[model samples]
Target: MPALVYLLVLMVIPLGLVIAYAFLTSGRFGGVQGPATLDNITRLFQPLYLEVLASSVVNAGLATFIAFLIGFPAALAITRLSLSWQTVALIAVVMPFWTNFLIRTYAWILLLNREGILSDGLALIGLGPIEVLYTREAVILGLTYAYIPLMVLPIYASLQRLDSMLLEAACNLGAGPWRRFRTILLPLTMPGIITGCLFVFIPSLGNFVIPELLGGGNSQMIGNLIRDQFLKSRDWPFGSALSLLVLALLVIIVMLQASAARRSRKWGA
Candidate 1:
């Protein structure tokens, strides 16, 4: 009962307010005022804002894919290690979280900037300076770096729970490594993969700081637009509408994750 009340007070109430604000008119100052209308919802369909949404999806998708490519191997490698070394490997995977996120992001800026370490190294190797900072690629890289650990943890948990005897059985039955992975391992670990992808994708879709600092504000995602609407433009109604869109997307993703998890359990059974 206490937890239910806590959720109502902290989550439900704020969400209800945001939904209400989305339909209302924006005040000349900053807050909502006047009769409710659908202008804010319609405004989101404009080509300019649609483009931002599209770019956010594409960038987030790319980051999720890249993180998976890196994280799956890392997770698998950790499972292969001895028990003591596995703990150390897991610690290394998550060590970045001990530092401030903003500081970590700033470190990337130092490395990717024109006169930074990357360019300096290129110069010594006789290669021309390649522009990386403030680009779409840089934003994607930053997203992948920041959230790859999220991908790794969930996958590692799934892998840890997996039965090694199943793989041994497959091997004894004459299945090769690739065949065992494709038939036994991949299917079993899919729930983790889905969870990991969603973890990376959702945050990447809404990330603003990485794009603002790393992409030099040239590449703006939906989160940046929402931030501008609330802070810079002071369009609370429109910002609330945009927030609703993101909330809706999150709900859908979560529903899909839940559905997949159920199916995975049934399949295991």
Candidate 2:
């Protein structure tokens, strides 16, 4: 009951305000007005909103893939370590996540800019300085770095929970390393992979700080567009509609993943 109170008072109620604002009409002075209509939702279908959505999807997809590529191998290695060392390694992996996200993104900006550490390193290596900050790729890099811990933690947790005997049995049956990983290990750990992907992808899709700092306007994402509509452009209705649409898309993705997981589990059984 106490938790419920805190959740409602702190989270649900505030979210309800956003929901109400999203469905209502625009006010004369940029606030939301009642007597709502479908116009806000209709405006979300405009090419501008669609483009932002698409950019967000692509950028988030790229980031999620990169995070997976990095985190999975790391998770595998963590699981392979001595049990006593696994705890230390896991703590090290997650330590970066305790820092502020904005500061983390800014650190990347310092490293990737033309006058940044990367350029200095390049010059020392006799390679010409390269521009990096404030681009789509930079945004992807920032997001991937920011969320790697989140992805790895879940995957590592899942991998640690797995039965080692099953893997041993597969190895005894003449399964090569690649074959065992593909047929046995990958299947068992897919839930963690999916969970990690969702954790990275959903937030990346709606992320404002990384894109705003590292991507600039050139790589505007859905979250930026939504912010612009409400705060910059003062289009409350449109912003609300955009928010709802993003939430809807997230819900759909979760549902699809859930269904796929259920099917996979059934088949595995």
> What TM-score do all the candidates reach, one by one?
0.96, 0.92
The TM-score, computed over Cα atoms with residue i paired to residue i, of candidate 2 is 0.92
**lDDT of each candidate versus the true structure:** 0.94, 0.88
In candidate 1, what are the lDDT values of residues 1-269, reduced to their tens digit?
99999999999999999999999998888999979899999998999998999899999999999999999999999999999999999999999999999999999999998899998899889884888999999999999999999999999999999999999999999999999999999889999999999999999999999999999868999999999999989999999999998888889989999999999999653
Best by TM-score: 1
lDDT leader: 1
Model 2, global lDDT: 0.88
Residues 101-193, candidate 2: write the lDDT tens digits. 778778898999999999889988989598889888999999999888889988998898789998999999999999999999888888889
State in Å the error of residue 76, model 2.
0.7
- How far residue 32's Cα lies from its native spot in candidate 2, in Å, is 1.1
**Backbone clashes in model 1, listed as residue pairs:** 134-215
- What is the Cα-based lDDT of residue 92 in candidate 1? 98
> How many clashes in each candidate?
1, 0
